[model samples]
Target: MKKIKNIRYPGKYGLLWVIALFCTGTIAFAQSGSDTTDTGMAEVSIELKYTEANNKTKILEAAVKTKVEGSWQGANGVAVQFYRNEAAPEQLLGTVTSDNNGVARMILPEGEEKNAGPEYTYIAAIKNNERFEDTEEEITVAESAFEMTLVEEDSVRQVHISLQTSDADGQEIPVGEVEVSLFVKRMFGLLPISDDPETTDENGEVMAEFPADLPGDTAGNLVIVARIEDHERFGNLEFSRKINWGIPLVIDPEKDKRQLWSSRANAPVYLIVMVNSMLVGIWGVILYIVFQTYKIVKLGRSKAAADTV
Candidate 1:
């Protein structure tokens, strides 16, 4: 009864064929949606700008935008609003129309929706309308008061900028892998310290070596500025802090008289020559007039004595 049990091929290759077919079919099904027209995705974006009015009023301007197919045309006429994510119906900041560019802008009064802390993250949302599906986006902004620390030991001075951001509740959270820009303030303008921007590490910190040739105040004071310019998430923000990490102005009093750059030395050559020459000429004229007056007085006294004798 060992007569060729139906001559079936029980080889592993046959099983592999069946598994491959199953995987291919599954993948095809998963990606089949991309070819359909109903899989359109909508995007909502929010940008924030902070400004201080008279250093007392903290103003925040938020630009909300709705985009469709990588452009704002998809969400045209969509009713967009910007407000804090809160309970109930949520705070209704002024409703703005999405212009042809699909952007709606509004300014939140100072103290109304304070995003300075992590807990106060803002939200930009659009109501679902007949044209498109309802979509929303949340925004988190940290105070622009970025802090930097400088350390100099053994001629190896290192400057580090922290990359911690506040959550919706003003809670400190480490931000990973963000671009940072460093600049040194000079007499004319901000000078870029490095040609390439630096990125924050896992510890939410960006560090760079202090340039020795960087010029500072006459007393070696430097106003070093660290900035995060035009970030997709954080927008444009900067912080300038003063540090004494530069070469002070070098002035030699003997070989090189004090120029305008050196406070210990005299004024410029042209200014000294003009000023001293004027002073000497005026004193000479005064001394000549005084001598002539003394002689006249002496002659008058002698004539009076002779007349009396």
Candidate 2:
């Protein structure tokens, strides 16, 4: 019985013992690394969950987490510093204390770098202290932007929406294989015309048929819109064009109402006839006046010719 009790599970301490044994060789490796402080023991460690990405304004942010063994969760109230590593000049962005839930927030300011992609590298670190070991975590983020346009053809009755990148210059350089969504404008909301996004070709253009089934005003005026959303680089970009392709609108609730159109289409037959008769009478009087002037000029020319003879 005594031997069995001694051989049984060592509880939490037993798990730590096993982990220490497994990480014994690696602990020496961590000591040599700049990311680690010489820890008196291995039970307490810092973890960086610095990979969560958020882009607002010109900055990128990350979250840092720390923990100690035998504790239920995070090691609370730990002080941490955020850093941006370019090459020679490493900037200390700010210092934030770990919250009650044991999360420290960090930031990287102004997404510009000397590298080709201008990818920014950031580091979150817990400074050396008596209670816990110092630890560092690093992550990278890149800059991006987007551009879009819409085109229409009357002969073919087709709509072509093109997507490109204007990140470098204001010029429309073609970008291939990008997803684009198309929508047709409606009275209350936008009606989706394309079931799926059309991928751009080598020339950075996607063609989709404009929908003609929706109801519009009597003139059949409608607009087609294209949108790209939640893109990591450009965020949300949209463009729209007006076209006349929708069905003619009917304002009357009942059919066969003998209405040319809604209230605006109604006109009295007498009013129309009177307007046309007045226009014809005015034009006829003007024509008679022009004829009289021409006859007078001809007679004057004849008299001048006789006098010269």
Candidate 3:
């Protein structure tokens, strides 16, 4: 009996100990789950770009996105701030709101980069956003530019593109062995003008013959674009010029005549005639059936009168 009592005492405590451990583990799991829920705030990303285009134009662009269901989606209407430097009392360039595609742009005035050194640092930031955590992106881009010239001689058109970088004294120095792209802007997107890629020679210049037969606007105006894209040293640089070098695209008035692709009010004459004729035929059949029924009823009444007589 003594041995059994001792065993029962330890057994009771052992069962209680097991129950205590289970409770502690459950509490820990619940705490961990709550932490996970608290971290459910959207994760946001920011992309910064520096572009130098025609007529010494420079612009800063930022793209904001958030993680949703394991996929990134644009976060529209987010306010993004641009700065020339990251150090505080930051040199604020401008503040802009993100558009439908979560892109924000700020155009820097001319000569804005005159004092900017050979290497420039640009920063874009989002602050105090409730739906997303504060985030910032920075890019350091080297100063570069493109010079483009158009020449037509003896009915042969050629475009000249030059890639140059700023020296220590801010003089234009040639950057050789770099690839450049030439394009013509269309209604939807840019179209490549050359079949082969154009690479700069030792003089930082590349020339390509332009297609003389390409269609342009009614005035024969073409917007030509030259670009150096995704360069590790220079980033993206673009230059554009407008010239009267293309064939005028004259539209035909016959295309506006009523056809299958025309609007409802401009439907084809044949389709309208066929539909009206079908409607008239169906109504005629219905009216003939009604008239026949009336005649049969009248004959039945006359027959009944004869039978009574």
lDDT of each: 0.61, 0.55, 0.78
**Per-candidate RMSD, Å:** 25.2, 27.8, 14.0
- True lDDT of residue 78, candidate 3: 87
Clashing pairs in 1: 117-170, 118-167, 118-168, 118-169, 118-170, 119-168, 119-169, 119-170, 120-168
Per-candidate clash tally = 9, 0, 0
- The model with the greatest lDDT is 3
* Model 1 lDDT tens row, 1-309: 001111123345656655654567756435422221222223344444543322234434445454433454323466666656531255766667765655565656656745335434555555544333345555554443355788888989788887676666666777778888888988888999999888888878887997988777679999887877655555455666787888897765564665776454566878778888999999999999999999999999999999999
lDDT of 2 by residue, 1-309 (tens): 000001122245656555564588667435522222223332234444322222233332223333333333555576766666621224777777777776775543444343434344556666554444555655454343333334455644576665555444344567677777777777688888767887879987777766556777788877777766544444345666676777777776554333444253455556667888999999999999999999999999999999999
Model 2, TM vs. native: 0.35
Instruction: Arrange candidates by TM-score, descending.
Output: 3, 1, 2
Better of 1 and 3 by TM-score: 3
**Which rank order by lDDT, best down to worst?**
3, 1, 2
Considering only N, C-alpha and C atoms within 3 Å, which residue pairs clash in candidate 3?
Answer: none
What local lDDT score does residue 256 receive in model 3, on the 0 to 100 scale? 81
**Model 1 RMSD vs true structure:** 25.2
Q: Give the poorly placed runs of model 1, Cα more than 4 Å off.
A: 1-48, 51-145, 168-171, 251-309
- Evaluate residue 7 in candidate 2 and report its C-alpha lDDT on the 0 to 100 scale: 14
